[model samples]
Target: MTLTSKQRAHLRGLSHSLKPTAHVGKDGVTPAVVRSLLETFQQHELVKVRVLENAPDSAKSLAHEIAEKLAGAHVVQTMGRNVTLYRPDPEEPTIALPR
Candidate 1:
């Protein structure tokens, strides 16, 4: 699913106060990291991921990698060391995107 501009903005706004749930360390995007992302998606639907200073790649690359690994997740925003992703949970979606 694709996020419209308004929806992206909405998600971005929501991310402001959210703490990073997953951190990409020097190991980069490992299977363990992806697994954590999956759990984050399952629980939070929308989550913030942080790329540490020692991470192997850029935040954008890590965001895309996370999105690609997950089924419905997409990168909504990225700023400096942080990136936000959204993947609506069919069971219980807490976020309401702008149409």
Candidate 2:
């Protein structure tokens, strides 16, 4: 799903206090990392993933790659080594996104 500036801003605020759910290291976005992220999404729509300095790619690229692998996921924010992602549950989305 494509998010407007307003929606992205809203999600950014919601993820501010959230700690990094998955940490990407030298392994980059491995299957294990993707699995963990998927599991994290099961509980929370907004998830923060931290890319370690040793990670192969930059935070932006890693975030985009991860978003693509996950169904209907979007990159909400990417700051420094931190990447915030959002993917609401298809059946029942908990977070109410503004138009």
Per-residue CA lDDT of model 2 for 1-99, tens digit only, reads: 599999999999999899998999998899999999989998989999999999999999999999999988999999999999999998999999999
The candidate scoring highest on TM-score is 2
Q: Give a tens-digit lDDT track for model 1, residues 1-99.
A: 799999999999988999999999999999999998887677788899999999988999888988998888889999999999999988878888879
- Model 1: lDDT equals 0.89
Assess candidate 2 and give its TM-score to the true structure: 0.98
- The ten-residue window of minimal lDDT in model 1 covers 37-46
Residue 35, candidate 1: alpha-carbon lDDT: 92
* Residue 64 C-alpha lDDT in model 1: 95
Give all candidates' CA lDDT scores. Answer: 0.89, 0.94
Misplaced by over 4 Å in model 2 are none
The candidate maximizing lDDT is: 2
TM of each candidate vs. truth: 0.94, 0.98
Candidate 2 yields a Cα-based lDDT of: 0.94
